[model samples]
Target: MEPQKINKGDRNKIYFLVIVIAALIGTNAYLFFKDRQQSERFVTVSTEKDKLRLEVEKIEVELDKVNALNLDLNEKLVEEQKLARVKIEELKAALEKNQITQGELDKANTQINELKTFVKNYNDQIIQLQKDNIFLKNSRDSLQNTLRNISNKASNLENENANLNAKVKTAAALKLQSAEIIAFRTKSSGKKVEVTKSSTAEKLSVRFNVVPNQLAEKGHHNIYLRVFDPAGNLLADEGNHFEADGQDMQFSHSIFINYNNDDSTYVIDWANPKPFIKGIYTVILYADGNTMGKAQVELR
Candidate 1:
């Protein structure tokens, strides 16, 4: 079979068709590549945004760690921390947008760095404050030791002076007169009813009168109470101590009252933590480094 012969008009027509088809193919290829590049760029931007978000989270975690230390922060450091948190929140808000431009991303990055710097400065200040506090504590302890040594060196002479002072204080000390103690059962409605039964007694009601003394200083005084069970065990809370007659003594409760150098009546209501036992309970009162009075109550 003979090959088909090409004429000028037909040949031109064929060339035109070929050119049109090639142009369409090129246009389609260009559009496809452009769409693919745009998709890749979007994915890269999203990934970077996520990474930035994670970095912000890390910074926030660091801030939380510092906050958990519970250090007493000064005014400046507190304000700096507040501002850092605000900046972090702002960055987070900006990054939450659906589309972030490169410029916006760069800006966020710069803000993040500033936030890091602020946190570092805050932490440095906290460390310095801690060091200062430690130094102050050590200085206080050293001064206390030196004073104790001086006190020991003059012990005998101080004792004679203290003895004279004790005589004077004893004369001026407030005394509890007509001191009385009674047991009571407190109801859920907060009413107290007198009770002599050990199983029903929940608290003790103490009443006393302060004897007038011309030598006593008229001012506020702390009246300490000491309760003893039948077993001779002092009833007191843990670490409840007061200074009495140059010695540390345990007491159940202390009351603050005002004295006008005249007879004044006072009351102290004490609730026992443990149930009352069927025995005698002794109540002693002290003020101004001396025993004021003692009273006893029995529960059957």
Candidate 2:
């Protein structure tokens, strides 16, 4: 009976142990399944986070490109604006210079018209004087012819013939009056000078006057005025010519005058129409083969 009881107790103990081991194995299996599910959920979250980070990086790159383009465009705009402003200033300066030149041209035109009118009047007076001289010449010739016929005729009284011949000779001796040239005030002043219209070397205005004499013959005569540099060289070109002392000479410039009265004043203005250098200039007037007057001036 003792052996049988021992066997029963051992079997009961083995069975109880087996039951406890099985319970532990089941709990471990449940815990392992729960852990695996949690791991899968964490992996999905990490993948989503990586995708979001990549998208943000791409957007940042695009923004940087846009900012670079904007900067380039702004720089180009500034350069163009600067170029426009510079052009505007240049145009303004050119316009102002043109205005000044136009004004000067107008004034020159007016003076030239006045000079033309004076020349026309002088020519008319000369024509009238020529007519008077022709009549006088015809009268003198007729009187001389009559005296010659009377002297040849022996029938005429001798004393009367001699007296008439003497009168005829005296009348034939009379001739047209001679012309005189008036001198300038500055002829004795030995100075050389130049005159310019502007300081910028754009143009020059030259002016001079001529005097008339009544004792001169009523005829068309050429007057010459020569402009010279400080070096005593003629400033005018070769085409100009005038009559001086009953001879024709190549001059710088000349004007025609009909002497009808004494103290006739004449003025002439010349346009340089070219650039000039800084220096002194001299002016000389010649008429009837004589130097009538001179003037001098300076320019800087």
Candidate 3:
């Protein structure tokens, strides 16, 4: 019975030791788990902090870029404003020049109208001068005939004396008249020469009258015209003997006419195939080597 009690005591001691060892092992495992959980939490926090820092840097860079773009836009706006100012000044200058040109045109129109009126009055004076010239010529011819008849008579004294007195009377009746150009006038259709957008040709109509010079030879005389562009270059003509002031000249066109013992009116039509630049144009007319008239026109 003593041996059995001792074996039972050893068995109880072994069991108690095993229980203590188990308790120590459980404590160590609990500490390891807790430490592992803490490490995981720290890693998570560090990763979040890095992400937030990166987002802040990205925001700062975007703000910087926006600032640069704004500066560039401001610079462009300033340049645009300068260019706009220059354009405005140019437009203002052009408007002023146009106004001045309009004023000059009005003055020229008034002068041309006055010239037309003067030419009409001059025509009337020319007709009366022609009649006076004819009467003077007849008186001179009668005096010449009386002188011839007196030269033939050589015999009777009183009869000769009376013939001399009659010849003297006829000589006193004779008169002299000077020949001159009566008047000249030109008229144009006030309508502008229209160049259609799709067409290259244009038509011009001009009308004029020739003043009578009673002493001038009654025959055919050549007439001419010259058209000039705004650039002062002569327009081309396919037909016409181009001469001006007894010199060969480049002309737009020419015409021939017979002025047979009367005042005359003339109208001419001209066709232009060349493209015209937009500006003022001039037309000069010549008759019998003399400048008869001129006209100005504008095109837009």
Best-fitting candidate, scored by TM-score: 1
Candidate 2: residue 12 Cα off by (Å) = 99
lDDT by residue (73-160, candidate 2, tens digit) is 3454445435433533443343334223434434433443443443345335445545666787889888888878876675567767
Q: TM-scores across all candidates?
A: 0.50, 0.30, 0.31
Give per-residue CA lDDT, model 3, range 1-300, as digits (tens): 545455788999999999999999999999999999887866755554444335334433433443454332346444543553453344334333422343443443354344345444534454565666778889999998887777666446667788886655443321112111111122365545444221233655566665555544466666676877778877776555655455776567777776654546666666555665666667777665555667756655
Ranking by lDDT: 1, 3, 2
- State the C-alpha lDDT per candidate: 0.88, 0.52, 0.55
Lowest summed lDDT across 10 adjacent residues in model 3 is found at: 174-183
Clash count, candidate 2: 12
lDDT of 1 by residue, 20-79 (tens): 999999999999999999999899889888988998998899888878888778787778
Clash list (residue pairs), candidate 1: none
RMSD of 1: 22.4
- The candidate with the higher TM-score, 2 or 3, is 3
Residue 2, model 2, lDDT: 50
Prediction 3 TM-score vs. true: 0.31
